[model samples]
Target: MSAVRAIEPISRGEFSKMLRRARPPPGWGKSIAVANSGGPDSTCLLYLLHEYFSSDGTPPGNQRNDSTSNSHQKANPRIVSLTVDHGLQSSSADMAARTARFAESLGVEHSTTKIPWGEGVFPPLPAPGAPFEETARRARYRTLFDEMTRLQANALAAGHHLDDQVETGLMRLRLGSSMLGASGMRYCRRWGMGNVIGGLDWAGVEGMRRWIVRPFLGVSKDRILATCEANRLEYVVDKTNFQPEVTLRNAVRHVVKYGKESAQNFPPKLLQDIETIDTALENLPNFDGNLNSGPERLRAFVQEMGREVEAIEKEVDEITHKGRLPSPIGTFLISKEALEGIKDKPLVQRALVLRILRYVSPNPWGSLRAQAKRRSARLEELARCLTTPMSALSKPFSMSSQVLWKPVLKRPKIVKGKSKGKVPAGWIASRQPPDLQNAWGVADRDITEPLLQALEARESEGDGGALDILFDCRFRIRIHLDAIPQAVIDALAAGITNLSIRCDKELYYPSVVLRTPKNELVLNPADNPTPKFPEGIAFAKPVDWVSIEFIRTLGNI
Candidate 1:
């Protein structure tokens, strides 16, 4: 290790220097887990933090008389340098070992977790390719998170940088991500990973004990590389990163860098423009109410975006049909349809889409172009060279064609809501008869429209999600349906006996299941589906609460 030097010096304003000075805010737990893969960014972080803390005892910024001439303020966490070995690489185990040694060299407490390492391993885990990358990343997190909890490490850290962020934003942009995806990574967020053992929600959740941290996001790739260079550190650059066909991040890592550099030319001006966009977003009065509406404005946005999303999907389908992967952006943008499909749970859906898209590589058959094409000609020549036997120990070679298998969506048209309707053509399960589909979105209008509108108004003000009540109708309303669970049927029938229908309108949508009086034995229509409980039964829909006297005969109890 040697003295540090800047790889790419920031022009002060271009970088978010505030992050350099920013400490974890109050209430955020403190012990840090730096995912020190021996990558330059992480190594830099380790070196800075180790030095930062060490120097603090001697003096503030000013050096004591015995301090070396060029020494800088050491920046360190109460650092635990952790490495995740996905074991997809032949050198992965060694990489972990080497990283551990390197972390020790930096005078930091280091640990390593070997993930997905087992017998029958080949060039990549599960015998190499795109699936291997996902296997590696997920395993890496699982191990890291597990370690975080086992060690009770309070904050989980990573070495993601500006270049990575820029690449991610570009990837999201290409994918036609909705507003949140376009928002880029937040500085911090609660980890979605949580656990409950035996249905008790306490400190028992596995990963919930540790908060994920990314201190380096506000920094640049150059700073990390500079730190690595200054420390004389060696990082193994996985050959797959340069292979475009393997991951969108690799492709955009190349493509997005240009934009980052171009922004450098007029850094101040571009930043000013970015700030202007922020100002506009900030000025918009209620985010969900105004711009993100259901009528003309939002409907138009959805309509226009609807075209783009459809076009992108068509492009992806055509490419796959032709036995190829779309460009990184193409794959990402095409995923918006999948995201839009789960509109109610937007964040969950976006995360799912992002996780799946990151595994695709642009190059389909990267290494074996000539061999697979000229197989007929090689047959005769190979007959003479039969003395040579092939071995799995063939110097870590991978043909990459194995990773090119296009993803097959076995179950399409995943309508997640209790029900949905008016979806785009080709979006839902086509097998579901069209007439049934037509009635899918048809709201039951007569259950009391004026009253329901009032309920909707109350909900608009952030009331509880829905209200359910069951009472007898004076108007002989013959509500017929069979999908309604027996318990609900009994409740509703009993309610009808002593009925006083006041707020009947609130019970019209998918949230309510009505049954005709004749089908009192069993009345459940297409409107609802309940989890099958072999014994105790379940609420297929809201529990119908009839007036007092009606309750006596509910469920014929």
Candidate 2:
């Protein structure tokens, strides 16, 4: 690791400027939620946001004629402090209380959400190299988003500073990330646009659009500490950060703090490159227009794209509707004309390919990037084949091992009593044959592969019913109680009795069934039992599937 150039301390004015740049439009509403963890960075962020959004800082246009009124009495955008208690440490509850007090001192509303780890509401720590931090972070943000929704806040803010950004970049580099990942964190991103560091699986949750704002991305950690000291703010330090062996982030932090200096200053260029890429993506062939084109032109462009995209969507839908591809999983077929049409338009080709790949991939975004890098040569070959004349492409070809194309002559249709002339031959895209396994091996290069394997192992061993599987860090599967072995249930009952468990009354469980070792049973209140065992527990699968929730949240994006 190379030492990063020290960043200058941030002043309140500079902070305000950063906020102005990242602030959402007025239409998103003025309510903001601050994720306060009672740590230095977050504590400072809470103070700064409170001051910035207070009545004293209200715009002149909204001021009243009454000069004698108290500044606090004036109306301003509502600011709320949200603290999530992960219950990982003994001092977590105390920290939550302290954070609430601090928010009250600043006249900000505060709330705390507790994650019951022992109650099986939260997933267990992941296996090595499976992004444990990313999973925890997603769960934390999920809690925050729920709170924001309940509070009717349009935006949520966090305290991620320059040092954090540097660490993130280094981690992404180590992970063999694409240019997007190497570019590091953005000052502003959509509420759930999962980036390289943060796995995209959990980001597409509903009601998460353009709701997260990080105003301190440009400020250094030292500067944040200095601001806290200048204001005499109290903050709790997490001791885990000092233990470099515990996590990669801590190791990176130590290196950045003490490593020898290097001439390269990568962050500025990285950010610029990311901005340029974003501009290019926004101005794709279907979205060609100047930035200065007013909102009306932008709206018109969006509508036009919407119509065009829908046509493509309908075409894909029709392929499935025709019963040519019956199964939802595995290989599917597309018309040769459709493939040629996509080949003629570069952007459409990329979009259509990405869409098809995403349909079968567990980690769609990661898979897309990996396929692009690993199969670049094959992709180019396929593109050339598609553009060539049909007579020249008579031989079977493949886009990649995963996407195979074979030419087959289409039978000519008879018009009345005579044959209508030969119809152009179409192509079929399907999975490569088993003998060609080397051509398209299963995409096992993903970080989530090991985790998926572990889940499958558990399922095979019949332990899956007792434990919920966190699939791809995106979905959770809770098997029905009946599927669990009796011995497992007996053991669980014994443990619960030993622990003297006290369940939260307000906590909702979709399905709960308990049986004692003595053949006694205690079922959830909602259960409807059978006659054989009058007190036996009945099970009904819940309608709220985790995968469905993910799809609903991210929508069509």
List lDDT for all candidates, in order.
0.41, 0.53
Alpha carbon deviation, residue 368, candidate 2 (Å): 8.0
lDDT of 1 by residue, 1-557 (tens): 99876366332233223233233333334456778777676776666656555444343444566555545634334668899877667787887887898778877788887664543321235665445655566556666776777676666667776556655543454444444343455444434322222211112223223456565655567766765676577776667776543565664454333332333333454344433433443343423322122123333332343344444445434423432323321122122234234345433333332222222211111112212221323322321121122222212112221112122222335466443322221111001111122223323333434334434565568653333332221011223222224554355445541112221121111223333444311122333332221233223323323111111100000
Residue 236 C-alpha lDDT in model 1: 62
Predicted structure 2: lDDT: 0.53
**Model 2: residues >4 Å from true position, as ranges?**
1-9, 25-28, 56-75, 118-121, 124-135, 193-205, 208-210, 260-557
Best by TM-score: 2
Instruction: Provide the lDDT at 41 for model 2.
Output: 89
Candidate 1 segments whose C-alpha is farther than 4 A from its true place: 1-30, 57-77, 116-125, 194-209, 258-557
What is the Å distance of residue 365 in model 1 from its true position?
40
Q: Provide the TM-score for each candidate, comma-separated.
A: 0.41, 0.47
**In model 2, how large is the Cα lDDT of residue 327?**
23
Residue 219 miss distance in model 1 (angstroms)? 2.5
